[model samples]
Target: MVIVGILSIGFVVLAILLVLVRFVFDLRLTAIQQEADHSQLFRRKINHLRKIEQARHIRYLLIICLMIGIGLAILIGSFLVLMDKQQKLTAQNQIDHERIIYLEKQQKQLMANIPLKKYPEEGIGLEEYEWEKWSEEKKDVNLQRQIESAISKRSAQYFDSFDTKVSLSTPKTISLQLKGYTDDDASREMIKSNLDAFAKEAEKVSQLNNIHVRMITSVSKEKQVVYSVNYSRKKSEDKFNKQNVSEQNLKNSGEKG
Candidate 1:
């Protein structure tokens, strides 16, 4: 840019000098023509000489005009380019500002569509936490279906075949029930252990006001309920977290309810 400015200045200076030279040359030629002998042919010759000089100077003036035009063109072109780049920068800044506003307004919208609950093993736990949060703020918004499905799906992995159902009476309390046919007494213990695992895992991830796990089993193929009992909340919730008082207690009350 400095080079361009220097060249433009040089061109303008040269043009001014050329104009001054033409002015002085015209005056000298005019004086010579007047001082010449007043003969017709000689005066005609002087007039002819004057025409040639004028034409030559006009050509030099055109050359000077060309040089001046080139310099002005470069300066104008540079200004236009600078203005274009500034417009582009302004447009980019506007886009960046809009993105910042969107991020600030909707934080939860990020990664909201990922099937975290179905694909990942810990997805249900995440939903449980979300439920604890969203349940208090909005009405008719809960993740109960996913929670129930997760519990039922996990039951087979931990214990013998048992159909599972879960009910959320409120945001803070939930009930789990498992029913299956089993004659071996060991099967009941396995079911209880698995129930404790499920509840504990849930508690680790979410909040619950009351927790109770129930199981029903029968020895015969008729599927009549022979063992039906409800275990109370964890001792951590009631000064006692034991799932059962003992195996003896489970058996003693197993047939009664």
Candidate 2:
């Protein structure tokens, strides 16, 4: 549009200049034709001079018009380039904003958890030592009591939430709702195996039964189950499964299996 507008304006200006040149030439020609003796000779010179002036004027106008068109094209192209850059930058800005929010949520969740007390991982059995710490934390944290007191209490305040439960039961079958971060077995098994191991050790734990372990995450306020497995007290073939905000069931607070 800009290019067309500029070219159109150049054409109009050229037409006006041509008309003015014609009018001047006509007046000069009339004067030259009036003389008697040298009328013919003067008329020829006037015609030649008019042609030269016309050529010079048209050339100047064409050059000016071409320069204007080129200027308009450059200006419009530069504006489009700026607009394209702005759009890409806006999209990148949005992605950065989302990433920041995700990191902040992770930080908050970490801050809410219990601080770690490092123990030897090589020689010492984890269950023998960790149970003392677990017992203290399980009793100390106000939220765990609420969950332990009643199995049905599904949610709790942030930081007040720890994702583990140990029970004394001798039932034919047991259901385990495992909490995990990823879909991989190493990641998912952290909670499931951790619970199963603890359950085996805990007083009157199931020995001969079908234990169903489910790996799930939180979606909105509800639990989203991602993986599931059914096995017996004796080792059995493993089978599959899931981001949750408020984590469920951890023996140690502030840490993930």
Candidate 3:
């Protein structure tokens, strides 16, 4: 666009210069005619007037051409920009499609690795065991789904029994902490039983162990219960720490394995 604008301006300047040169030539002709006595001063003035009219016509034509050139330049530039944007959009869409396909393939592979339990429905199975057979990918998905389901179910059950509101935070490490009020020991025990059952069901489906249930209460006003479960994989540091302690004990007793 800028280049076209520059070219258009240059052409306009050239046209103006040409008109000026032609006017100067007409003046020279008038002078020659006057000196040669071939034409009177009035005739030379008339000729000069004719040249002015022609110059005006040329100037108008030049202005029209300049406007048309500028309009074309702007239009062409806009079209080029639009085409470039469309190409970028097309490329981005292709990239997104490929990424989606790759993720779907990854999901299928992970699901294949897990041991799926057959249900009455064909092509549909329940994840029955503690997701130990699942790959890291499948396990993560299963774990998140399980945790969310448990939280939703437990939260509803807790709220139903007590008029006091109960809110559940996001479950992390298979632990849920609840806060509310209970009528009596029976009510508290009921809530505890409900939470314990939920934890057991989760344990059956996921690789977790040693589920712990803890509750805190301020008399009848509020009560909070926390459920914690350990993932199946033990941390390397914990194992190493245990081994080191055992080795130290064995050395003190002068025994070796």
Give me the candidate number with maximum lDDT: 1
After superposition, which runs of candidate 3 have C-alpha atoms over 4 Å from their true positions?
A: 1-51, 118-257
lDDT values for all models: 0.59, 0.46, 0.46
Clashing pairs in 2: 113-254, 114-254, 163-248, 163-249, 163-250, 164-249, 164-250, 227-241
Best by TM-score: 1
Clashes of each: 2, 8, 0
Lowest lDDT 10-mer window, candidate 3? 240-249
Residue 8 of model 3 has an lDDT of: 58
Off by over 4 Å in 1: 1-129, 137-142, 159-161, 222-240, 243-257
Put down candidate 2 lDDT per residue, 1-257, tens digits, no spaces: 46656665665566667667767876876676676778676778877886786687678667666765665676677678779999999999999999997875685466345332222223122223222332342333443344234431221121122342323132334344533233233433344444344334322322224545454543223333345555554422222111121335332332334
Could you tell me the TM-score of candidate 3?
0.30
Higher-ranked by TM-score: 2 or 3? 3
lDDT of 3 by residue, 1-257 (tens): 56666665666666567666766866776676567546576676767777776777677667666765665676677678879999999999999999987875565445334332221222112244234433244356655566446444434444222112212222223344333333355655555545444443444343343233334332321223322222222432221111111101122223321
lDDT of 1 by residue, 27-144 (tens): 9878977884678888888899889988998799898999889878878877788889989999999999999867633432332221112122343342343555534645343566
lDDT of 1 at 42: 81
